[model samples]
Target: MKISKIKEYFSDEELEIRFKSSTNKRIRDRWHLLWLVQALNYFADDASISLGYSRSWGYYWIKQYNMKGPSVIVLPKTRNPEWLEKKVTDEMKIDLLDKLQKEPPEEIGGGLWSGPKVAHFIKVFYDLTISRNKGWNLLKECDYSITSVRPKHRKSSDEDKDHFKKKRAPKYC
Candidate 1:
């Protein structure tokens, strides 16, 4: 099939500079496609094949660049979704951080602070039912670490503890 040549929107030097400077691989590939067609006289099929892209992929970007100029190739940097940011306000985060610093109230099933506990607290106070993972993320943001202390038997006294330690003393001594 016959393919159309890419229109020169920017100079070959400019395309070369864009290809070199672009940090995103996808953007660099698009720039390379333009550079090959406009600067090196490579046909769309060969250029796409060399770049490990299909001819239609090359055609699509070329058509976009030809019509929309250089801006079409640039993608926005990734960030958290707008709704997520909106859902958890700065005030709420500050409050959560403050709550994590203290003992949990009895109203929210008093216990050591944990992912599920934090999630339950949010649900109780903020009316938001969040996942345990998200709750864990909140704990991390608050600089709270989770740890477990060794369980002790209520019946075991200091004498029993001493006897156990004596029995288990290192043989090296």
Candidate 2:
């Protein structure tokens, strides 16, 4: 079995004050555990159990206090950075809505706003050039829907399917 010890510096009154004044319950108990070991001469493990903390809790808290004071009782905290910056702001949504009502898609993209058009619009208006999927997501966020109306090409082509079927018929069948 290994033996653990806690270093004590503050008096009973100071320890009680720290225990009462601490906002974090865990830190307050740490203070009490240190006090119990130093003032009462109780073993570190026993004090930790009486304080309802882990075996390492008393050792770590005492180590921290020895290094600093009551200020270093709480453990360090860390947080992850944001995943993405919001491109479609509320203001941008309002601007898009206002412009959409003023002009039709044909006037906007000569018939439709394709992926490239979306990229251009995002660059020109919002000043943020996002991908086609991002632009589509932005439009969808604003409850806007897009539909294709069968764009016509300038090239001439015969639409007679029955004429091709008769000529291409096999002699065996």
Candidate 3:
């Protein structure tokens, strides 16, 4: 298949500046691809081969350049405000910490402050639906750690525990 000539968008000097100034290897390679095709009169396949990239990659970028111009290679400067907004605020965190210190509210049932309970609390009070994992993360952020209590035998006596502690305990330094 015949490939059409790439349109001149930036001059050789400008392309060289772009290629040199680029911090990302991927973007620099794209600029280098353009330089090879436009300045050195290299075919897309030849440019791809010279740049150690696949032919399809070269064609894809070339097609993008032809359709969208030079700005396609540039990174977006603006961020989405909605994405940047915090779902949980400082006040909510304070409230969560206080809630965790006490028994769970009646709506969620009385028990330990688990991930599901935390999530349910957030859903009820804050009007937000957070994941169980995020709830655990919140617990961790508040400096709460996981705990497990050892089971006690029904027939075991305090005298037996004292005897084991006094005699059976390891004495290694």
Candidate 4:
């Protein structure tokens, strides 16, 4: 609507009353005052302050007030993507498994997966970036121990297979 038309609809007395009520000293928040000032601009006779504000800013305030009423001008909600919040995926676990299996146990650093090493490998090979903690989680999920323990030696007799019968016989007795 034209400024002249807005002024014709609401008299100067009405505008002053609304402005004073909206900009009450008791109200600590500036948002209400901002909305009132913007609304007043639509009908303001003086062209100085109206011309000072950017047209886009005025349009944005007008659009917001029309769509959501005055309260929406306070602040907008903030949110972060769930994927960025934490990394947990089956593909990451499989990638870790493949790397472990392809490399010899001795070749693998520390004879087990270390968080940073696994994270680096993922970034270098798969191009799937992840944090050290996430890599540790993947190892834990796969039941791979981080400790450095030598492979146990087995006796020839035990490998020959009568061990099951010998062990069961003792338990039965």
Clash statistics: count for each candidate: 0, 0, 0, 0
Cα deviation at 151, candidate 2, in Å, is 32
Tens digits of per-residue lDDT for model 4, 82-167: 54644546676786787666543443354446777777676665666789887676667777774556664575565566655556
Which clashing pairs does model 4 show?
none
Better of 1 and 3 by TM-score: 3
Better of 2 and 3 by lDDT: 3
**lDDT for each residue of candidate 1 in 1-173, tens digit (9 for 90 to 100):** 43657777789999999998989899899899899889998887788889999989888888888887787888433443654543666787899888877878798877789888888888888887788888888888888975668799999999888876745557894
Q: Tell me, by TM-score, which candidate is best.
A: 3
TM-score of the candidate numbered 3?
0.49
Q: Model 3, 1-173: lDDT tens per residue?
A: 33647778999888888888999898899898888888887889888878999998899888888888998866432444654563878899999988877888999877678788788899998888889988888888998754547679999999988887855668899
**TM-score, per-candidate, Cα-based:** 0.44, 0.39, 0.49, 0.34
Report the lDDT of model 1 for residue 118.
83
Compared with the true structure, model 2 gives a TM-score of 0.39
Q: Count steric clashes of candidate 3.
A: 0
> What is the Å distance of residue 68 in model 4 from its true position?
16
